[model samples]
Target: MTKPDPIPARLAALKTTPTPELKKQWRELFETEPPSFNRRYLESRLAYRIQELAYGGLKPETVKRLEALGEQLDGGNITLRRIRADRDRPIVGTRLIREWQGVQHVVTVTAGGFEWQGRPYQSLSAVARQITGTRWNGWTFFGLKNHRRSA
Candidate 1:
């Protein structure tokens, strides 16, 4: 004679059962109102609850350690990230393309700085000035800044 695999069998049955039936089962199993979760969520949680009843839940020491770690991390104020110039720049090996005065300008992103016309340059504005013969914000020239370019 083989023993019935109750947990898995119940989980499988829970999948096909309707919401009301699952709710009734929940009431019988837990003697409480079922949460308004979806069918799959209900089944999975119910399956876990059934297994927990049959076996056991998290160890007391594990729960205590987790709670202690949570308390340690729960600082009252939210930490703000500082804005950095390096963070504002693109990652290395990225290529940025722009068209000005019916001409296409290409700039390669590098660890040192932006590269243009087979030469390494320190800034995008410098590259833009070289291309346009006028002073311009490197970020604005490259459309990386929050300003709209004039048509």
Candidate 2:
């Protein structure tokens, strides 16, 4: 039987590798200056690179499909850094519309917060409260999240 790959052990060792050595590995793997993140970042990225090379990275068709999807998601402006930046936050320039009491309201996501009818609010919940005149979880009201269970 084929022996198990030794890459996993090496990846684990990366957690304890010296910062300088990790930087060297990073350079060899990516052929660029390592980002100025932290030791854990270096180790994780290096590990992924090692495994990707030993095995194979994503298929060409998969890459193309993902690129097409990214373009559709972000109008062809998607990048790794951009996706990471927007991962935890809503995509800027996206519009959210909700109807309350026969009136439809639109909110646009901004860098700082969400804009509702020409006013900026820090959170969707705030806008929901303003619109409903009652406490609410904005995501649920916006249909972005499931309704909260009543206890």
Candidate number of the best lDDT: 2
Model 2 stretches with alpha carbons more than 4 Å out: 77-151
**Model 1: per-residue Cα lDDT over 77-99, one tens digit each:** 23311124566678899898999
Q: What is the C-alpha lDDT of each candidate?
A: 0.79, 0.82
Best by TM-score: 2
Q: Estimate each model's TM-score.
A: 0.45, 0.48
Q: Tens digit of lDDT per residue, candidate 2, span 1-151?
A: 9998798889889988899999999889999998876677788889889999999999999999998987766666547545544465557998989999999999999998799989999888999988987667788788876432321
Backbone clashes per model, in order? 1, 0
Model 2: how far residue 49 lies from native, Å: 0.8
In angstroms, the error of model 1 at 108 is 38
